[model samples]
Target: MTKSEKTQIIESLTIEFKESNAIAVCDYKGLSVKDLESFRVAVRPLGIKVQVVKNTLASIALKNAGADGLEFRDTNIFIWGEDQISLAKAISKFAENSAGKFVIKMGFFEGNVVDTKHIELVSKMPSRDELLGMLLSVWTGPARYFVTALDNLRKQKEEN
Candidate 1:
């Protein structure tokens, strides 16, 4: 586009990347527009943003945002969000279903540059909500068993 437009985009993206918890650079070479749209829809609810940006602009933006060490090349689609776990999970799941058409090249997570394997590991980790739910279950387990045991004891005493 025009120089002004490019400048505006760079400014906005710099701000966005600065606020992001993680950014995944994916190679979406063989995927269709429809596939990309559906992927966008799927991750929108998770607060992830999907975009196909010029590599140079993206690199500048990332560098301006204080993230470095990533080199973008060849048809990259950027997937980013404020939640690293969700971003990793969503992109990894999409990559799994893409059948080699889409690939996870590398990522910037929490100030560190990571690879596909590292992204996969982050994806497999429990989300904040899932971790909270597991914690709640564990915390209430003993109380629940105690109540059940007390009820059973009362029933047996009444029978006697």
Candidate 2:
């Protein structure tokens, strides 16, 4: 690519790093183009963007975005999104089926460098929507009990 093109790519990647909640890096060395395209399709619906980036450019973007301590190496496919959990879950699922082709290098989430183990743990955790639903249930529990108590009182008054 030309110098201008490289500059543009860096600029855009820098923006992406700034906007994304988390970024997952993987070594997609043995994967085919078809596999990569299929992976992209799977993640696109989840608001995730996957791309193969040159290590140097990615390093520059990461540094520019203030992400400390991620080493970029050969054949890196970057997966990033607003929902960190979804990114982790999606990549984890994809990697799970890859036998040994897709390897997890590391990740950056909420300003921390998360290792592969942590990424796997995060992947298994419920999504943000699921967590929110759980919280909503908890929040409504007291209200439900209050209404039931009021109904019981009304029944007693009627009996009297």
Candidate 3:
């Protein structure tokens, strides 16, 4: 690629990385184009982006975005998003479903380099929406139980 094109790519990636809070690097050595595209479609709704970028350019962009410490090698695909938990969850799920073809390397979470284990841990945690749903359930539990009890009391009185 020419100097200007490379510069443009780096600048765009830097902006993307700056907006994203989590970035997961994966080795997509044997994945087919269709598979990768499907994966991209699946995560697109979650505001995640998937791209295969040159390691040098990606490194420069990442560094420029203030995230460093990941060593990129071989064929890599980057998955980044604003929601750290969503990013971790999506990549982890894709890695699992892709069998051995797609492998999760390391990641940048909140501008700090994190290991695969840390990423996995983050994936297992509930997402923001899931947490909100759980909180709503907890908040309504008492009222639901009270209604159920009142209904049962009315039914017993009618039987008597």
TM-score of each model, paired residue for residue: 0.97, 0.85, 0.95
Model 2 whole-model lDDT (C-alpha atoms) = 0.93
Q: At residue 87, what lDDT does model 3 achieve?
A: 88
Among residues 3 or more apart in sequence or in different chains, the pairs in candidate 3 whose N, CA or C atoms overlap within 3 Å are none
Clashes of 1: 0
- lDDT per residue for candidate 2 within 1-160, as digits (tens), equals 9989988999999999999989999999899999999999999999999999888888998899988799986789998889989999999999999998999899999999999999999999999899999999999999999999999999999999
lDDT of 3 at 85: 97
Q: Write out the backbone clash pairs for model 2.
A: none
What's the C-alpha lDDT at position 41 in model 3? Answer: 98
Give candidate 1 misplaced runs (Cα > 4 Å).
Answer: none
How are the candidates ranked when ordered by TM-score, highest leading? 1, 3, 2
Off by over 4 Å in 2: 142-160
Best by TM-score: 1
lDDT of 1 at 96: 92
Q: What's the true lDDT of residue 45 in model 1?
A: 97
- lDDT of each residue in 124-148, candidate 3, tens digit only: 9999999999999999999999999
Error of 2 at 78 (Å): 0.9
